[model samples]
Target: MTHTENTRVAVNGYGVIGKRVAAAVAAQDDMTLAGVADVATDWRVAVARAKGYPLFGATLEHVRAMTEAGLDPAGSLDDLLGAADVVVDCTPKKVAAGNVERYRERGIKFIVQGGEKHAVTGHSFTAENNYDTALGRQSTRVVSCNTTSTVRTLSALKQAGLLKKARGVLIRRATDPWESHLGGIMNTLVPEADIPSHQGPDAQTVDPELDVVTMAVKAPETLSHLHYWTVQLTREASKDEVLGALRASSRIAFIRMADGLVALNSVKELMADLGRPHDNLYEVAVWEDMLTVQGDEAFYAYMVDNQAIVIPETIDAIRALTEIEADGATSIEKTNEALGITGRLVPEPVAA
Candidate 1:
């Protein structure tokens, strides 16, 4: 569909992430906020309608009214499937999976949140690292926010041939029980002792040959999740080179190369300073002195807040996966180059 007509987009969930997605879509010049589908009769729906966003099928009449107003409303979730070219599945994990299959069968494009419960048929995408891969790809899944942040930096390092092996520890805070019925809260500071933690596997899905390990700790706070990364480099790459490369990435906005220890609170403040009116895709608060250079091993620590780090990436992914045109091709090329997987490579060094 042409950009003018492509304005019609549907959002399947209306929670925090869904609401943000809806706002982002509505703000776009080429896209229109078609409707929203949620079981609950939350105030957000009214907020959407007040902003002239058409509310489609929901469990309640207020949403039904939106359908009557030329917005398609499917009282049954299945009815919502055929209504739009793109469906953003912000529903809970279990619900998201079923909807994904249904959309695939009906030949609809979809955007699934990282925490969704279902398996989707798209490449794992981050705008900075994987937008080129997402372009024209029918199905794409945005990786978890933490995964996006960590992988973006590491991917750049990999491109420079500085990264050899990687390990990380993630301390996450659970949201309210209603956030995700599955466990997100209730657990704090517990070490996930398994080698190659779940985050590592997620990263590998994007780059199969990457060697990485991860551990998890659940915190009580609900604002953002944090990560501590230790990487072993193949060569003697300086902290300045690493930070400079990271800053060069358009996908990364706020990066602080810490001379000493940098706390999570400080990172949050840096995020505030970046002054991104919308949630950012990712930011790097580098702990440079925390960088340990032991022989060939290089360890670095950093922090990323999940929501801010993933949202903008999702926006860029949708633009790439769909036929929506941006202002220039240069942005696309730069994003691909940052990911290290532009599908063009230089020959490895040969010994004399």
Candidate 2:
């Protein structure tokens, strides 16, 4: 295999996000999926193997277990890292932080998911908000799914000089759909213990100047997250102006309930109908018709595909860390093109 102009990317987990990241990385013209490493021999990891990603064990014990299970892993995690230019740590919460020392010891550039604290990388990333800060940097933490959508939407308004302060309520999914059978809430809601829940602060890590506060509660379903925001604009603005401001960012897509995307599940179904890989909704699905403006206040709601939203940001972060693309817009445009992320999902509005 020749490594002339591509960045070799090793993914540290093959779970929900890892599997998606692996696929996205393999789709890029300037990046290569070196392999995926995980301790499991279940269907998830098996799928990666089926897709022809080189397998690796996170530990010697894992290697033995995988071998016993007939999953032929190439080697340990270190072997995977040694073969790549950069690694994306998609391990579960707190686990990726523990792997940081290993990555640094090998002088490998790495990116961690939002599960870990900002202190883990000392710099948090959302492609549009902070790409240059991560340029040529050894490491960065891609903020979680919720934070990614929040930053993308708010940054759009901020850039247009329409943002003053935002107060939002997030109805979060209980768990990834794949893991719902394991354990999740039933017929009830679980609210985050604190007001201005951690998501608000997490978004701040990506853009500190944005005046935003959030409250979140977990719902029973796993389709996706719903965020309703009441934003105080810098001045009174019309719906079209606000929509245009949001439309400026390529990652924010407008979906209309009038087009039969009345709910999150409907939107997910649309993704499958559109032939999106893994039925992924890479853009923040803001309801175009549902948004309203009253004087200087604007209200809107959007759906966040928890499993898929962060995938693009992670892709952009890969380019930023590797310096494969110097301009953030170029990296975003390339990623969006490869992933088929047009600002509109349904080309023609469906008649209700």
TM-score of every model versus the real structure: 0.78, 0.97
Off by over 4 Å in 1: 3-7, 59-83, 116-119, 176-188, 254-262, 266-282, 287-295, 326-352
Off by over 4 Å in 2: 1-4, 349-352
The top-ranked prediction according to lDDT is 2
Give the TM-score comparing model 1 with the true structure, all chains together: 0.78
Clashes of each: 7, 0
lDDT for each residue of candidate 1 in 1-352, tens digit (9 for 90 to 100): 8756664577888777777677766656556666777765456666666667555554556456655564444454455655676777878765777677777788878888777522565478766566676777667787887788678878877877778988888877676324656656554356667766688888877787789888887786665676777788887766666666555655544333442225665555544554533323245545545555665566666666665566556666667767675522444453334332232111237899
lDDT value for model 2:
0.94
- Tell me the RMSD of model 1 versus the true structure: 8.2
Model 2 lDDT tens row, 110-136: 999989999999999988888999999
Worst 10 residues of 1 by lDDT: 338-347
Note the residue pairs that clash in candidate 2. none
